[model samples]
Target chain A: MSLIPSHERPDGDPLRPIQRFCEVVTYCATLGIYAYGVDGPKVCLALPYCEDILGDADRQWINTGAITTLIDSACGSAILHALPQYEAIATLDLRVDYLRPAPAGGEMRCWAWCHRITSNVAFAQSEVYVEGIDEPVATSSASFMRLKPQKREAG
Target chain B: MIEPGHLKAEAALPPPEQFCRRIPHLQHLGMRYLPACVENHSAPVFILGFQDRLVGNTHLPALHGGAVASFMENSALLHLLMEQNGTSRLPKLIDFNIDYLRSAGPRDSFACCEVAKLGSRVVLVHIRCWQRHFDRPAALARAHYLWEPVSGNTELAEDIRP
Candidate 1:
C-alpha cells in the first residue's frame, strides 16, 4: 500500500473524495503513483516503476499506458487543489504529450498546476520528470467538472 | 507487456493473439483483438471486458477514465503494429488526447482505430470507444506514435520493409 496519507485526514475531513478516488483509481495505485505535497495552486505526485508495469519481459521500459495514467492522475489531482473545499471532480478531457519513453527502473515525479477555476469547470497542466534526467519524459493538460458532494459510503 | 528491450532482433512475427499476450497490462486489463471487421476496414477491433477492478466511481459505477484511456492508447499501438509487421520494436508514444463524450457504463467495451496519417517516422491514429451503441461513443481519442518505419525510408520504404 502507498505510505502517503490523505492530506485531508488531519483536518478531520479524512476523506478528500477527490484524492481518495484517485488513490483507489486502478492505474495510479497499481503503478505506485502517490500524492505528494500541495503548493498554493499546484498538486504534485510520484510515479515509481515496478516490475509489473514493464512493457515486456525483455525490455526494461514501462508501457505508454502507465505513463498516460500518471499524467492523467496528476492533472486530475490539481483540480482538487484548485477547489475551495476540495470537492469531487471528474475528468472531461485529458491531453498528454510524451517526449520519450523513459528507461524502466527509476522513479518519476509530476507537478500539476491549476490555472483556471470557473463555477463549474477546472483546468490543469502537468509535467512528468525522471530523476537524473534533464528533459521531461512527458507533459499533459486536462479539464475536470466539479461534482456535487455526496454522503459517505455506508459502512 | 511486451518487454520494450526484447522487441528487437526479429523472428517470426507472432500472431495478434500472441502479440497482445506479450503485453501484461493489456492482458491483465482484459484487452483483446477481434478480426471479424478487419476485412471491411484495414483496422482491427479491440474489446475490454468489464470487471470490478476497472470501476472508478463505485456509486455511479462508471468505468475509470484512466482504464478507458489506457485501453484506447494500447489499441492505437496495436492497430498500427497490425497494419504492418516489419518491426518488432514497440512504437514510442508522442502524445495522446482524449475527450469524454459520456460516462462509460460498467460493461464490456468495444473500440476501433483508424490510421489518419502514416509517415516514415511518425504515425497518427484516431480511436472511438463505445459500449452499447456504435453511434454513441463513450470517449474518443487521438494518438501519435513515433518510430522508424520498418523499411527505414519515408517514401522509398515498401509499406513496411525490414
Candidate 2:
C-alpha cells in the first residue's frame, strides 16, 4: 500500500509551497532541482541532468558535487515537512556514500525522511536513484541544527 | 578507456590545472587552482569565488553546504592527482563525510587537503575549507577514493611520497 497521504500525493499541488521554497535557494535553483511532492513522512526531489553538470565528460557521469547538492536539498526539505511549524535550520553534518556512478542524461530522484527531531537537532536520510536504475546510486545521512525561535521585542 | 600509447611516467602527465579545467561542474562553480608555496603546504590550494548562485540561505547569506563540500572534494581530488602524477582515469569517490564548523559568509572560499592514508587500492583524504582565517575553518571533510590501477604505471606502487 502507498504510504503517502492522498492529498499530498504527486498528482495534487500540495508541494507548491515547498517548491516555492526550493526556488528561492539559488544553489538549488541553479541545479534545476524541483520538489516532486511529499510521500508519507518523506519529501521527494528530482535533478534533471544537463551537460554543464558533468564531472567526467568522457564517461558522461554526473559530478559527485551535484549529487551532494541534490541530497542536501532533499534532506532539508524533509526536515521542513516533518516540522509542526516553520523553523530555521542549518546542516550540522552530512555523509554521502557513492554506491555507483550515476551516468549523465538521466534524471536523478531522491526521497528523504526526517526520522528523529529533538529540541536542538533533526536527523534525515536520503536515497538517490537514477532513471532506469533499480539500485540506489548514492545514499546520504544528515543532521540539521534547529535554531531557537527569536523572541520579539516591542518597539 | 586509456590508450596504451598515452601512458607515460612524469613528463607526459598533464598539469593539474588542465585536469581540473576539464571538469564541467568545477568550471560551472568557478573553482580555480592557486599555486601553494612549497614551504607553507605540500598540496595545491583551490579557491571558489563567491557568487550569487552559490548561496544557500539568502537570509544568512551563507554558502551552501553542498557548495562547500564540492570545493573540498575537488581539492582532495587535485591533491591525489598530484600525488599520483596524474592517472588516465579519475579516482572513484567511495564516500565523503563533512562537518559544518561555521557558516561561510559571502567571500572567496579556499580549500586544501591532507592525505591520511595512501593504499594501493584506496586513499583517504582530509580536507579543510575556510573563508578568512585558516584557523577558523568553515568545514572539514574526510573522503575515501578508490584508485584504479593503470597498467605499466609505476607511480601507484610508491604510495603518496609527500
Candidate 3:
C-alpha cells in the first residue's frame, strides 16, 4: 500500500504532497511537530512543549533529543523543498550545539535550509528559537545521503 | 521521587535504572536500562525498543536519526552521572556531535558510553550505538557537558532544590 494519499495535486505544486507526507510521519507526529510553511528556500517547523517531551522534570526543560528531532525533521523537509522532485534521503551526520537550555511551557520554532546539494549528498543547517527569545537556543548542521530512485517492476 | 539533597547525602551515585525512570522523555521513548553484563564493557548499557512511533523513514523502515541520537545522548548523560559521585547539580549539555555510520534498522537498538575526558568544569563522553552486533556500530557520538561546582547559600540552588 502506498503511504502517500492519492489525490489531485494542488496548484501543480510539487511540495504539497511532500508537505503532507511529512506531516503524517509517525515520529514527527508523535513529537507534535507541524510544518508552518516554506519561506523562500527555508522550511519552518514548530514543536510545542509537552510534559512527555521534557528532559528535566524539576527544571521544566525540553529534552535535547526532542530539539534534535525537531531540527532533523526540519532539515529533512528543507531538502525536500529544495529538490526539484521528491527523492529519498537519509541523515549521514548531525551536529547540534546547545547555546542555551530550551525552557518549557512555550513552543519552539525551527528554520532549516538546504545550503548545498551535491550529486550524492545534501547539506543543511537549522536554528531553533523559543517564543519571545531573541537568541537561538540551539543550532545544528547535518548532511544527508541522497538515495537513487528505485526501479519499478514491469507490468 | 529523588530528594534535592540526595546526591549530597550519599557517597555513591544512584543506580541507572532508578535515575532514568524519573526522566519523562526516556520513559516516553520506552528506553530500558540494561546491566553492564549485557555488553563486555564495564559501563552500563541502554536499550531502545522498536516501535512504530520511533520510525522516521517508513520506506526504509529505519529508526529516526533523532531517536538514535537521543538514546546515545541519554546514555552518555547517565554514564557521566553514574560515574561522577557526589555531584549535586546535573551536568549541562554544551554540544553533541554524532556520525551515522549505518542506517538503524527497525529493531531494538543498544548504546554504551565512555568518558573520553574528565576535567574540572568540563566532561567529554564518547557514545557508540549498535543494533545487531557491538562490533558493527550503527552510530558514534561525542558529547561535551559543562559541569558546575555546587555552591552553598546560592538562590539558584535553593530554587532548584525540591
Candidate 4:
C-alpha cells in the first residue's frame, strides 16, 4: 500500500512547517474566546489593531488573552524563520510572567527573538507591550527542539 | 496520605465546596473537586468544574490568559478542601506556567486535575483547564500548595488577619 519502503524514510522536514503548526495552534487557542471575533495569527500583535481588543482603562489590567496571542504568534514566526536550519532548531520550554494587566480595548504587540540555538534545542524570548509604555505587560521565553533527516548511505 | 497541614474539622476552616460557590462562573463551568479544602492563609486554590466554556478557538474574544491562570489557581483551593474535609492549611503557590498556543474564543472554559503529590508539608497538583468539546486546551497550569499545621485557635486568628 505504501510507495516507499519503511526503512527508507523521507528526506528533510517539510518546508515552512512551523507556519502550519502555528496555524493549527492559533485556531485551537481561540476556541474559548470565540465571542470576541478575533481569529488567526494575522490578528496577533499588529500594533494599532491590538488596541481594538484591549479597550478601556478598568478592563486593561485584566486582559491577558492579548498577551497569549502575541506570544504564540512571535514563537511561530521565530520557528518559521529558522525553518531552513531545521536540525539546529527546537523549542525546549517557554515561561511567561504577567507584571500587570493590559489596558482594556487595546491590542497588545509582541516581538520575540530566538536568542540561542543549541545542538538540539532553541531558546527564544518575547515581550508584549501596550501602545504607550516601554515596560512590557508580559514577558515570555520558549524552548524548541530540532531534528534532522538522516542521510541515506550508498548500498 | 494526608499532609500534616491537612485541614481537619478541628481546624475550623471553610469548606472548599463553599469557596467554589464563591465564584458563580466556576460553578457554571462545572468545575468539581476530588477533595476540596480551604487554607488558613494564602489564596484559595481548588480544581475546575466538569466543563470549561472555552476550548479550541471557538470563544476568541472573552477568555484572558490571566483569567485562565486565576481559574487554575482558585480551583486549587477546592482540591485542598476535599483532601482535608474542610480543615485549615497554609496555602503556597510554588509555580505556575502556561503556554499560549492560540487565543481562545469567548466561551466558558472547563478544567480538571488531581494532586500529583501530597507530602508531609507540601502538596503538588497538576491542574489543566480546557474548553468544552475541544481536544486541545485553552491552558495548562500546575500549582504546588504548601500546608502548615497550626492550633485551631491560631488558624482562626490567621483567617481573621488582614
Total clashing pairs for each candidate: 8, 0, 0, 93
Task: Give, for candidate 1 chain A, the lowest lDDT window spanning 10 residues.
Answer: A1-10
Models sorted by TM-score, best on top: 2, 3, 1, 4
* lDDT of residue B133 for candidate 2: 74
DockQ order of candidates, top first? 2, 3, 1, 4
Candidate 4 second chain TM = 0.56
Q: Candidate 2's interface RMSD, please?
A: 1.1
Candidate 1: clashing pairs of residues: A55-B1, A55-B2, A56-B2, A56-B3, A59-B5, B1-B23, B1-B24, B2-B23
Clashes of 2: 0
DockQ of all candidate complexes: 0.48, 0.70, 0.62, 0.07
User: What DockQ would candidate 2 receive versus the native complex?
Assistant: 0.70
Give per-residue CA lDDT, model 2, range A3-71, as digits (tens).
Answer: 443246554354755687689888989888888667678888888889768887767788998899899
Query: lDDT per residue, candidate 1, B44-144, as tens digits?
Result: 66777777777766677888788889889888888867776635467778889999998888887777888888776678899999887767889999998
TM-score of 3: 0.83
- Candidate 4 wrongly placed segments (more than 4 Å): A1-22, A26-60, A63-73, A85-91, A132-134, A147-155, B1-162
The CAPRI classification for model 4 reads as: incorrect
Candidate 1 residues lying further than 4 Å off, grouped into runs, are: A1-19, A56-59, A147-155, B1-18, B37-42, B86-88, B150-162
- Which regions of candidate 2 deviate over 4 angstroms? A1-13, A149-155, B1-17, B38-40, B151-162
What docking class should model 2 receive? medium
**Candidate 4, TM-score vs. the true structure?**
0.44
